[model samples]
Target: MTGGPATPPTPRPPLGPELEVRRLGRFDYARARDLQQELVAQRAAGEVCDQLLLLEHPEVVTLGRRTPEGAADGLDLPLVEIERGGEATWHGPGQLVAYPLFLLPLGRRDLHAYLRDLEEVVLRTLADLGVEGERREGLTGVWAGGHKVCSIGVAVRRWVTWHGLALNVSNDLAGFERFRPCGLEPGVMGRVADLAEVPADDPLLEAHLERHVRGVFGHR
Candidate 1:
């Protein structure tokens, strides 16, 4: 889903620099998107602080501004046009979706640099678990052996980031088969458990993911 064009950065909030993280469980994609829109609106209105929201969505496919037509594959998976920048991708119970609402200083409106920082967070998390991951040129996700383990699509309004990244933790790969992931071939999709040899049903995997995410985005 593609959001509108970047807006001019507003003055920073008075709160000392900090990152706010919230964990939401099993939210619907539409609802989550709505929440993001509301947050962006609130930020524009100067009614809220910079924050990051993490959550999982029920099975849903999202299409971005550049979403490929052939990638839909005639499937009926619910599609929501989002403000984030990217192509089509899947989200389900086992996937982790992070939406960061941050106010970038006026001169710091660099989308490419922000994307690289977000990718680094995921790469560092995967590396903590012994999964070697890297980024491919022209792509915005982390990959393990040519297969994408994480997908990132984001939107910024007035220099405040909204929609964020999604990492496949233990979701069913069958749903992913319904679309060309991030407009890439089916062979490019991957999951955390598939790479780590951990059981998809294991709660420990989620715990570890949460820990790593906290470490990566924690207040310093």
Candidate 2:
């Protein structure tokens, strides 16, 4: 019941020479962030392979490092400034957050390229469900029509990366109304259920997301 009707059980990619997956649920951003920092330190010390920490954050609006003043204009939600890159966005239950901690060689640290690959993972998942999407110019997420279906904001240090993307599954967008999502034009946020014309809890949707994620990062 993981992959949707259109999604096949695709083969997982080999995580090259270093990669790990830490499955967690219902975790807060603060704890997740702490784990990310710890994992980064571990990788630096060669104590563990690069890892992907998956979890859901409590309802919160996070403003990234480069976010400008008023980027969250008109939003009344609880806000927290974090170490990630990009503008402001919301995270809550029902949404899936992925934090990939990897070490890229100095010149190999391409943040833009990394973001595109992450977007493609979501886009491909959506495509399998007959939902076509594209990357908008000057924007950092996957979009269906004009609504943002996935949000991307990442951070990099010395060629290592942490804090990845968030995809709205069945989360309440009402909370999104409290802010201009990712500092985009108001009302630009969206969910998979909204575009797929199906319930977010549909067994197929969950399966597809999990499979797609495994597929995306399976290759280290």
Candidate 3:
């Protein structure tokens, strides 16, 4: 009776790229963005291995490529303009933001395929937490019971991805009302805690996400 199919979903073929996962707890939004920029360049140049940057940002609103002018007009949170895909979205404590600095190899340069892979990882992670997540047709994030619990928007530079997805865990979702997220109504946003029983101090959310990412992408 969860959100997705009763039977387990099919596993995706693992990309098995070497990945370095870094957890930066309570990081600043601007600083994290800057770090991703640096890492993307390094990864593109083969100076560093592919990485998965996991962390939470303080309250901030970001405008992506598809965001309309003044989309963040009335939000009191610090606003930042970014190059990621999608519209305005919020990030704060209790939400996990993952920036995967992955350089697509010769045969894996398909953006659509990469996005679906990310969705699958989130779906599997939700399953681990007893929350069944599903994908809405033409939508980019994972949803449970018709509410979107994750928001994904990525940008690629020289086939290396930077801006990535954010999964709402226990964040204050009131700020989502200030603007549309991915051009959808504010009420469309959902959190894992709302659907599953997540202990306030539990580390399982992050652990599940990391494990699923590695499992789906075949990363070590």
In terms of lDDT, the best-performing candidate is 3
Q: Write the per-residue lDDT of candidate 2 for residues 1-220, one digit (tens) a residue.
A: 0012122233333344555767687887778888888888887677887777777788888999877898776666667899887778889987878787877654445566667667877888788778888877677778886688788888876556888888887788887776667776658888877766654454225445556655655543
Quote the positional error of residue 114 for candidate 2 in Å: 0.8
Q: Model 3 misses residue 215 by how many Å?
A: 1.1
lDDT of 2 at 195: 69
Q: Give each model a TM-score.
A: 0.83, 0.81, 0.91
Candidate 2 at 9: error in angstroms?
Answer: 28
Count clashing residue pairs per candidate: 6, 4, 1
Which candidate should be chosen as best, given TM-score against the real structure?
A: 3
Question: Model 2 RMSD to the real structure?
Answer: 6.4
TM-score of 2: 0.81
Q: For residues 112-197, could you state the per-residue lDDT of candidate 3 as single tens digits?
A: 77787788888898897788888876778888967999999999999898888899988888979878888899999888888888
Whose TM-score is higher: candidate 1's or candidate 2's? 1
| Colliding residue pairs in candidate 3 | 16-218
RMSD of each: 5.5, 6.4, 3.9
Candidate 3's TM-score reads 0.91
